[model samples]
Target: MDGHPLRLALDLLKGTLALTVHKIRYGLASRLWHGTNLVTEQMSRHTQQVRLLRAGEVLGSLDVSTVRDEIGSRRGTVSFNGCLHQLFSGQPLTRQEKALVLAQLVASFSLTTSYDFADSPLLDGDDRLLMREVLYGAGFAAREMRTFIYQSRQDGQDTTADIESKSTREQTRSATRKLEVVDVSLDEFIRFHDANLAQKHNYRRWDIDAAFVADALALGKARILAARGRSADGLTPQGIQAAMIYTWDDISLKLYRISYDTAKTANPHANKVLIARGMQMAHDLGLLLDTDCAPPGAAILYERFGFPERVRTHYVRATLLSKFAAFIRRDFPSLDRRLRPWVIRAVTRVNRSAA
Candidate 1:
């Protein structure tokens, strides 16, 4: 199973080292998490190196054949291990609760993706297989269940790794956002991401479990948005957790979840803009990233496609009006209060793509 499709699908984590996803940078995770930012940058990167360790498909760009030689090959600002955690940690574990624990803990359970190497004390023999079965079910839908990955700044290091080989040109980076928990149907996830994905960059496949979604939905651990109908949706935000987000390559970059700090602003749009601005601050600090398992532009690309400037808007009642009021009141809160407009939870033809 060394070069098996599943093993090759994605790069595994290195050892038991902990991972930190910038909440502001991701989707599902962002909603559930409230405070505490493990990552210091606003951007991250991925690669086409690894493959689906489960299916033996060329899920990633970094293949086993070149493992040893590129173990620490510097990409933009990320590493193979870092990128693996970024993508892996975003997946839902049980879907039982809005924020499941097993899924997030699983991120650190095994650094490597193994086949026939089953010894996860977390799940016994039967339970282990059952877990895989659920993951497999989610894969069958073939819907985009947030396939991207990310890394937080290391203890003292600005952790946005990048893809830059000694002999090749370096990949570009983007503003990073704090990582957070978010959830959505594979279709909406895909559509929201692909619609705005740039032609120049893209992420590799993950041979993700087809049964994962059905299992999650059946377990009632999390909620999956319907492909055809929904006036609105919700999710959690904060701390270490597994979450999903639509990849930028998907065409429906709308309807993705976001974490809003009510204290940040009364006007919703500006609040979102502030989040984007914060991510840009992280990126400006030289925190963009890239790694071996994914293509050269993975990390920063994730943040870029999810940037506020490029957000996919959807109508949120008075958000249309409150957004304007927020803008007018950005400087003079007291004055704006008298003129402040109310925000009602409603829907209309607003841009669906926003962080």
Candidate 2:
């Protein structure tokens, strides 16, 4: 009531102009979001730098001489045969066996580790060479040791099996071959994948959802292997104890999912057995995975089957607007916090004016 009419109109005009400016800035920011990708590369480079620094520290402390000497001696490889025997025998590998398995896994890991963080510029030439020497030595030793066992069997040499009786050999064979890997229909695979694999953090992160699985099945791009246990009733269908899902992408057979139940009815060694079956299926179909973004467990399984390790590269592209928003939230916290309320009030004022 005390305000001059002209002054009041000028104030209203100022408020409208401020609102218009805010809207224009928001629109510009959004456009900027889609227009930029440099931030993504910068973030990736920083991540690689941190990881490579840690890797360099670990490799620096490694004893390359011992690894080399171990590889030269056939004793380590011969001992690893017992570990493989236990795996195929449906027995839980002992602590020693697990250690041996880790050693074997290092072979595949070493072949790719040096190149994995090639984007990082932090690793000096000498540091990279040290990493290569240690990794390569461990890889060589593992391959030599593991190869010795399998090669012994192929050569008809007296293996760990020689100590066991004929009946024991038959039992081991039966147990290892107990799982039947059969392909299932799309609907059947979906039901199994949804229940067993969908919600798993690793699979979910990779976008292996129902939609992806469905497309894989419908397009005949997948080989869904369901491990059927022995049927209790002669007429009843064999129950599914475990499943492995693989989708063929061009030249590579990508492992999508693999999980097994540990119930009394399920096989104790379903994990290794399913992996073996999956590898056999791959062989039958004439496929090999050049690059598989699977968990370490699955990677170990494939490496055990003599699959070569492949290097992979990932790209990240982010918009300018996203970077701007992140910057605003980080550097101008108060402004960021007030932004939503400002927008709400501006919209309300416009609505009131229209009414």
> Given candidate 2, what's the lDDT at residue 241?
72
Q: How accurate is candidate 2 locally (lDDT)?
A: 0.38
TM-score, prediction 1: 0.19
Give the alpha carbon lDDT tens digit for every residue of 247-320 in model 1.
11111111123222223222222222322322333344433211111233433444443321111111011111
lDDT tens readout by residue for model 2, 1-355: 1245456445434533433443343233532443311111111111110111111121111101001111111011101001111111123545443333223222222111111111111223543343334333332211211110111122232232421245434443465677666677655755665566545633232221343455455556666777776655645678677776766533335455665665697776555555555444445555543223445765554454444444322211112222233455566789878774664465456546755
TM-scores, all candidates, are 0.19, 0.38
Q: Evaluated with TM-score, which candidate comes out highest? A: 2
Cα RMSD, each candidate: 24.2, 22.2
